[model samples]
Target: MELKKSTQKRHQLLNAALDVFCLYGFTGASLDDIAKRSDMHKSNIFYYFSNKEALYIEVLTSVLQKWLESMQMLNVDEDPEEMLTKYIESKLEFSRLNPKASKLFALEIIQGAPYIQTILKGSIKKHFRGKVKVIAQWQTQGKIAADISPELFIMNLWSITQSYADFETQFEVLIGKTLRNRSFYQTAMKNNLQLLLHGALVK
Candidate 1:
C-alpha cells in the first residue's frame, strides 16, 4: 500500500534525522542539518515536529521501536536454542542494514539519553521486563542456563550484536578489511556469536 503524503514526508524527515543524529550526537545535531538531509525546509520540519528535541525523541523512538520488533521475533513456544540463534541472526542482520540507527541509539545512551529518558524508563523498560520473563521461563523449562542473569544475558546479546554496527570502523581497521566481506562476517562475527550464544544458553 502507498503511504499517505504526510506519512511519507514524516518518514523522510525521520530517516534524515537518524543519519544526522548518528553523525553528530544530540548536542551537535541541528535542525538545519536534518532539514538539509531531508530536503525539506526548516520550517517544514517544525511543521512536522514541534522542535529539534521533539524530532530527536521521535527518531530515537523509531530506532528503539525497530530494535524491539527484532526482539519480538522470538517465540517462547519454539525450541529455545533455535529461537536464540535466529534472534542473534536477525539482530546482526538489522545492524548490518541499519548501522546509522545503531549509531544514533549508541549516541543517545552514551550522552545519558536526556531526550529519551522518559521512554527508557517507561516503554523500553517494560519491553525488556517482558523479555526477561520469557528468558526466565525458558531457564525454568531447562531450555536456557539457569546460572545466567536474564538482564545481563540480554545485555550481552545487545552488546555483541550492536557492536557490529557501532564498531564497524574499529573492526575494519583492526582486521584491515571492511565488514562488507561476507566470508569474514560469517566466520568472524555471526557464526562466532551464534556459537557463543548456543554454548552459553543451551541446556
Candidate 2:
C-alpha cells in the first residue's frame, strides 16, 4: 500500500527526469528542470535521486535495459530468419514508442557514453558479445551469409533501426511526412527487413 505508492511516485520522477534529459542532454539538464517537469518540489526530487547524475543514469539504464531485453529475444533456438524478423520488428516498435529514449541513448553514445561507460564496458559488452557468438553459430550452420562479419552485421542492424528514431526530425523533413503517428514506419521497417534477410540468406 504505502510502499506501492512510494514506488509509483519514484517511477514518475524517473520518467520526468528522462524527458528533461532527452530534451537538454546530460550536462544541460538540471534537477530544477526535472522537479518542474515532475510537478514536485526540488527536495522531493532529491528524496528520490541523490543527485541529477544519479537520476540521469537511472533513466538511461531503464531505456538501455529495455533494449537489451529486446535483443535477448533473439534466442539461438529460433530459426535465424524468423528471429531476425522479430528482432527488427521489436526494435522498430520500440523506436516508435520511445523515440525520446532512443535519442537520449544516441546522445550518450555520441558524447562517448561518459556516465554509462562502466555499464557499456561490463554488462552491455558481455551481452552483445554473447549475441555476436549466437550469430556466428548461425553463420556456421549456414543460417546467414558465411562471409558476413558478425560484428559488422550487428552494427549495421543497430544503425538502421536506431536512425529511424534518432533522426526522426530529419527523416520527416526529407520524406515530407511524420512517422510518429503513421503505420508507414512499420511498413518501411518490414520492407527493409525483407531486403536485409534476402541479402543475408544463402541462395
For every model in order, what is the number of clashing pairs? Answer: 0, 0
User: Which candidate number would show the highest lDDT if scored against the true structure?
Assistant: 2
What are the per-residue Cα lDDT tens digits for candidate 1 across 1-203? 34588889999999998888888887898888889999989999977888888888888888899888878866677777777777888788888888889888888888888888888899889889988888888888888888889898888888888887898899888886544678876775656565557656754
Q: Per-residue CA lDDT of candidate 2, range 66-178, in tens?
A: 98998987777889888888898888788888889999999999999999999999989998999999899888888889898888888888888888889999888898654
For model 1 the TM-score comes to: 0.91
RMSD of 2: 1.2
Query: What is residue 121's positional error in candidate 2, in angstroms?
Result: 0.5
Worst 10 residues of 2 by lDDT: 177-186
